[model samples]
Target: MLAIGAAVLFAIAFLINAADMSTNDVFTSTNVMLIGLALLALHVAGIGNGWAGRRRR
Candidate 1:
């Protein structure tokens, strides 16, 4: 559930970046992209941690 929420948030951020890019806001778009990627990485890592812990038990 948490992962899904994070992913949705990331998607929204990505969309914002895309829209900004289309409007020629390169700097802000790039920042948004970076933030989205970071959030996605964290979300995936969190899910992996949860799954791995369950498997180890």
Candidate 2:
């Protein structure tokens, strides 16, 4: 749930930044958005938060 909220926030930021990039030619915004989407994708696929990189107690 929190992740979704973060994704939404990031998405809005992404859109705004993308618009800015159109005139400024910057990559930071795109990179951040991609990272956010990637994390959300992992979460949705149930592979987030060190799922395979950690052992459950």
Candidate 3:
């Protein structure tokens, strides 16, 4: 799920960059891309797996 979120973020960033849209400093394509990368890292690290509350028996 986090990976999916990251992919969406990356897509948004790419679109923003490709379109050359003007945005605030905090919402720039680079910043969005960084955020996406962070999410991807978290996903890889087993964070937000959505299975922590479940028990396997």
Tens-place lDDT digits, model 3, residues 1-57: 999999999999999999999999899999999999999999999998896676779
- Tens digits of lDDT, candidate 2, 3-33: 7755875976678776775434444676667
Q: What is the per-residue lDDT of model 1 for residues 2-57, given as tens digits with 9 covering 90 to 100?
A: 45655665676677766654544554645555665666677666644454434543
- Backbone clash tally for model 1? 0
Score every model by TM-score. 0.40, 0.45, 0.88
| Candidate number with greatest TM-score | 3
Runs in model 3 lying further than 4 Å from the true structure? 53-57
Model 2 compared with the native: what TM-score? 0.45
Query: Can you list the residue pairs that collide in candidate 2?
Result: none
Better of 1 and 3 by TM-score: 3
Tell me how far the alpha carbon of residue 3 in candidate 1 is from the true structure, in angstroms, after superposition.
5.2
lDDT-based ranking, best first? 3, 2, 1
Looking at model 3, which ten-residue stretch has the lowest summed lDDT? Answer: 47-56
Q: Note the residue pairs that clash in candidate 1.
A: none
